[model samples]
Target: MDREAKKEAFRKYLESSGVLDALTKVLVSLYEESDKPSAAVEFIKQKLGGPSLSEHEKLQAEKMDLQRKYDELLAAHRDACKELEELRNLKHEGDVKEMVDNNDAKEM
Candidate 1:
């Protein structure tokens, strides 16, 4: 679409989303400030609770948490596998010793 059409669509969106109202209020407050800010950008940022982390930052934090959990689970799985192997070896050794003892008894 043309630039005017895009602008109208964006304006409608901002109004519908209440962003226009919020921004207007913030701007009005800034205009009434006694100690006006040097930078409008900083004033807006401060008005809007300072700079906030975007969704990407939040997702990265969640990803790191999941990664940590996955690492822990993997380590637990390795330990369980090692324990299972040791148990199997012990059982095998016991079976072999029992078989040798039975053979000696039969010969006697």
Candidate 2:
């Protein structure tokens, strides 16, 4: 309910979830860097396992390309299935007609 209590609860949550440990390790790595990055926030972000903007963009492009290929393959599969069904129907009609003709010839 009070500010100190809230702070203690937040600290406990971070420790229990291992956020404190992970952040400490990342900070230690940044401290040990001989050539410190100009963008310290971005460096910390990357060290915290977040993707950089360029990597995120590249992934998005790759996802879009894969989706396009998937759509093309799906369309081709549907077209092939439709053609197969039409051929099956045509063959069935031909077989029925041939049987009827044979019956008529036998009757004659």
Candidate 3:
């Protein structure tokens, strides 16, 4: 079928949609007058990619930022684990008892 026939069929389909009556009228009018207003939303989204970051690009950036944050956190956690292991090895056997005794003396 031709573009006009397709536009007429779309108009018929859109008649059942009360929510989009104004949009349907506008698009149908445009479609009848010209070949425009027939492009689907996905087509427009695909066409508008990345002059200043489309929605998909923005989401990918956000995901990368989150992954970087997670990697930083993991690095910090590993450093903390290494430091904790070093502190454990450096601690004298009686150090905990000395601290407990000092705190008890302070309380008294």
Candidate 4:
């Protein structure tokens, strides 16, 4: 494509994808800053790195918390199952012992 066509295409892409609006808002925020940053890059970074970054961090923390809870619950379930199996084994042994005792009593 030619230079004019490429420029038009880039502008259209920026406008259609909301990049233009985001840049405009960032620039406006930088202009309104009481304590202006020394560097333009820093100003842009500060304005652009707004709520989205914090929201992502908050979501990560919540995910970690949920994962920890899930792990604890899984461990507890496994422990309970192990205990149940032990109880079952003990009950089976007691039944066998009772049968043997009854047979000996009958013989006597």
lDDT of 3 by residue, 36-107 (tens): 534455434444342323667888899999999999999999999999988886686469778999999999
* Model 1 TM-score (2 dp): 0.52
- Can you give the lDDT of residue 49 in candidate 4? 69
* Total backbone collisions, model 2: 0
User: lDDT tens string, model 4, 1-108?
Assistant: 999999999999999999999999999988898987778775686667654555768999999999999999999999999999999999999999999999999999
Error of 2 at 27 (Å): 1.6
Candidate with the greatest TM-score versus the true structure: 2
Residue pairs in clash, model 2:
none
> Would you list the clashing residue pairs of candidate 1?
none
Tens-digit per-residue lDDT, 1-108, candidate 2: 999999999999999999999999999999999999998888889999998878889999999999999999999999999999999999999999999999999999
- Order of candidate numbers by TM-score, starting with the best: 2, 4, 1, 3
**lDDT of candidates 1 onward, in order:** 0.90, 0.96, 0.71, 0.89
Quote the positional error of residue 105 for candidate 1 in Å. Answer: 0.9
Off by over 4 Å in 1: 1-53
What order do candidates take by lDDT, descending? 2, 1, 4, 3
RMSD of each candidate?
5.4, 1.4, 9.3, 4.7
Tell me the spans in candidate 4 whose CA falls farther than 4 Å from its real position.
Answer: 1-51
